[model samples]
Target: MHAFIVTGASRGLGYALCQTLLDDGYFVVGIARNAGPALEGLAARHPERLLAVNADLSDAGQAAASVRTALQQLPLPECATITLINNAGVVTPIAQAGHYPADEVVKAVAINVTAPLLATDALLSATGGLPARRRVLNISSGAAAKAYPGWSVYCATKAALDHFSRSAAVEQEGAANPARVVALYPGVVDTDMQSSIRGSDEVQFPQKARFDALKADGALSSPADAARKIVDHLVSPDFGRQSVVDIREL
Candidate 1:
């Protein structure tokens, strides 16, 4: 059996991914800040196969601890294949880099970049002895490639994550227990994050208009549908050492 771990599973893409994985018969361990109604419903449906954990991934120690706790929930003689989905992310209120609050920027970096790296490290270390195909999937964004005037912090963090994913993929290739590492752009989904961006003060952040257009044109994909596509890619036998793939291109 295959076991997968997903972060930010309380809502949006993360929650959708959890539901898809459970339906596909994979043992899933989902982490989030709070297990809200959606997650509660998922747990009730898959009591034996789904393990829901609540933790703030923005805290470095808490991020690492979440993975350790999930590892403990796996069946004894742990499954031969393990997948870690670093899907949790944060988009602070839009503002110029200089005007953005220091604490908010730090929190965004922690959740978007630092936490994912730490979580992947902990999972790889813990599963070093397991005889399974190991995989790490980093959820990236288009912001990593393009620059938006008001989203400096978000763009920087995601760009950093994209490069980190490539570097980590290279390292995994040479490891004793090689794991496939792929960073993917999951596309913009209709979620609270989008609303936050759209509702930002247009005076300080002029890009709110673009976000509004995106929302109005129905460019936003459904979280559940995007989640299904992501899980499909993760389990594909032909998924090679691409390292970086944009869902838009696919």
Candidate 2:
């Protein structure tokens, strides 16, 4: 059986991705702070295929432990492929760098940057000699490329994830069979994060009007649609052709 480990699986794109993967007959180990109603419902339906792990990805120990728990679900000889989607992220404390809370910055870095690295490490260590194809997909954003006035923390974390994928790709260049790592930009999806951005203080987040306009123009992609597009890109022929990818380009 094919297996996928998806972080942030309780809601938004993560929840949609879990639903899509289960429909495709893949076993999914969902890691999230809270296994919400959607995931709980899916678990009820796919008892054997879905494993909901209530985990706080911002905690280093929990992030690593979640991967270990996922590995335990895939017993020897039965698992065909292992895919890790680092989808959990935060875009908070939207203010000038010095004005943001210190603890919030730390939390953002922990969840958005450190957790993916720790999860990726555990995945590679556990599946190194297995015949299964390993793939690490980081849910990145356009903020990684452009500078947003009040989103310094969010932008920096995404940029770090993108560079990490690039370095991982370089390290796998000569391997006979290497784990594919790609930082995926899912575009502007209509998720809770967008809601948070729209509700932020206008004085601090000057780009609030832009997000509002996107919503007014119906330009935001739905999480379900984004999940379908992302899943299609993940299974595409040219998946690992580039270490950094934009869903629009797919």
Candidate 3:
């Protein structure tokens, strides 16, 4: 069976990805801070295929440990494919760079940047010798390329992730068993992060109206739809041709 390791699987696109992959007959390891009701229902329905792991990725040690645990959960018949979706991210304390607390900035970097880096390292290390098609998908955003009024930290971290993907792809060139890595931007999805952005103070986030208008005009894609599109692209022949992908283009 194929094995998919997905972080932030309690809700939003991460949760939808798990549901979709499981439906397509892949074993999924879902990592999240809390085991919400939705994930619990999924686990109850597919106990053998879905493994829910409660972990706080903000802790530096948690990423590697979580990956190791997920690998242990793989059933017999071994794994034909291994995919790591670094989907956990946060946009908290929305305010001007100077106005936000230093600790909040650190926390945001920990969750958005540090965790993914560590997780990727662990995944490659654990699956290096396995004769399976390996892939890593980093959930990135448009903020990585565009500058937002109060999203300095978020933008910086996502840009970092994109660059990391690019460098990793280059490093994998000519390797015997190379893992395809891509930083994917999932357009504007109607997730909890959107709600947080829409509720932000106008002074801090000047782009609030744009996001609010996106909701009013029904422009944001649903998590399930976005997840389907992303997974479709991941499995496509052209997946790894580009280190960075914007879902809207696909």
Local distance difference test scores for all models: 0.87, 0.90, 0.89
Clashing pairs in 3: none
Model 1: worst 10 consecutive residues (lDDT sum): 34-43
Per-residue accuracy of model 1 over 112-151 as CA lDDT, tens digit each: 9999999999999998888888899999998899998888
Full candidate order by TM-score, most accurate first = 2, 3, 1
Task: Provide TM-scores for the models.
Answer: 0.96, 0.97, 0.96
Q: How accurate is candidate 1 locally (lDDT)?
A: 0.87
With candidate 2 superimposed using the best TM-score fit, by how many Å does residue 225's alpha carbon deviate from the native?
0.3
Candidate that scores best on lDDT: 2
